[model samples]
Target: MELTLANVMGLVRQTFADPRGAAQVVLRLPMPLQARWAAVALMAVLSAVLMHLMSGLMPPAVGPDGQVLPAISPFFWAGMVGFGMVMTALLAFVVGRWRGGRGELADSVILVAWLQFIQLLIVVVQLVVLVALPVLAPIVEVGAVLIFLWLLVNFVAEMHGFRSLGMVFLGIVLTFVLAVFGMTILLMLIGVAP
Candidate 1:
């Protein structure tokens, strides 16, 4: 299928209805490995740009000490997001293989990038809601979280050819916990507070 605007919208709608099927469609896209990585980078940059724009619309965050925390730069967020996408793909490939999964790194990369794209669309909707109906922002936030988790679980299941979504979800949660713990330990080792 082509990457036209109409196709994307259709895919988004399909994703909401059947995330695993949408993931299958995404994985079937005729893109090379390098292109998949490029898509990941592009999605990261796009997401960061939207985040920067949204931050400008919202009030600055206040720390526990009542001091306003400095806003992060878009470039910094973009780099972090790109690194996250790459690492997620790598971990999914390596860990999935260890668990008898039959997915490739390229498939993981494209799926993650597509997930980011879907998130960008949700962010756009949230931005619109925040501006037009501020009271509904909380509802949108809740919906976004649900959509993200739903899509992630389905995408992982599709990528690894797993039949049980419950198992995929459990694995995702465990991996997330381990990743956070590892990151915390690494930060401590480097004398940085998480």
Candidate 2:
């Protein structure tokens, strides 16, 4: 089915209420690879913009010279989002297949894209709260993280057609550990670590 405004709203509601049902809907859609990538790109750009705005609201870090340090570039935020989207799809596809899942890469990509869209909504709400009541920003940030984790576990399990949520959770934990290890190695190589 075409992703009209009404359909998208319905899907979002379903995702919030029953993520597995949303995953089923995602799997049934005939979205092209290009379209899927486009959606990912759109989410990445929006996320980057929101992050940039949110960062602007924070107090700038001061250096030893008493000058405000430059904030992170927008390009960096966009790149991070792009990298995260790709890695999530890759991990989901590889780990799911290794676990004897029947899902394909396209399924993983679609599910991740949908999840990112949901996350973008959460980010928007957090941004609004941060603007209105800065003191509540920390609470909103923590709540968003918890909500995202819960949605991700269910969405990953559903996308992979896995009957065991525990297996999916374990797979995610392994992926995260490996990613951290790899990033540490990269940082060391780049002299970013002492």
Candidate 3:
């Protein structure tokens, strides 16, 4: 069956709301391979675009003519994709091993990349909503971090196994919270991101 854009968007929403369960859903589809392939492709494009947008939200780029422009740097984009791919593959191996999931490096790379795409989409939505109504900015940003941590926990389970999913979930929650604080401190020290 051909996957539609609407179906992909729904999966993206599901990924944010509940990633492990979402993974299960993806795994259970009648045509899991096709669905998975479509998801992986969509995610790659989304991550590329969203990474650029988020970078823009950070340090606003100034054009050579002194006009404000979106921060557009090939290095930054490369970092985004490279880091994402590496982490995804690593997590897939480690987590799949832990869970006895038999996830190959290539498989992990594909799934994790797609997962990041879902993650960036959520971030973009938060950024847009926060900018439109600044009062909710803090809530949205924190919420985005929580969702990521949740994904981390799910990825851990994907590798290790389901027995410790709850523990992994707790770990994700704590680590993510700590990461937020850690990242905030780093940003404050650096002046700002761009």
- Give the top-scoring candidate (lDDT): 1
Q: Write the per-residue lDDT of candidate 2 for residues 1-194, one digit (tens) a residue.
A: 68799999999899889888888998888888888888888888888998899889889989999999999998899999988998998888888888888778888888888888999899889888888988898998899887777777887888767888777888888889998899899999999964
Displacement of residue 17 (Cα, Å) in model 2 is 0.5
Cα-lDDT of candidate 3: 0.64
- The per-prediction CA RMSD against the true structure, in angstroms, equals 1.4, 1.7, 6.9
The lDDT ranking, best first, is 1, 2, 3
lDDT (Cα atoms) of all candidates against the true structure:
0.92, 0.86, 0.64
**lDDT preference between candidates 1 and 3, better one:** 1
Model 3 weakest 10-residue run by lDDT? 27-36
Candidate 1 stretches greater than 4 Å from native: 63-67
Model 3: residues >4 Å from true position, as ranges?
Answer: 16-18, 25-48, 55-74, 95-101, 158-160, 169-194
Q: Which stretches of candidate 2 lie over 4 Å from their true place?
A: 190-194
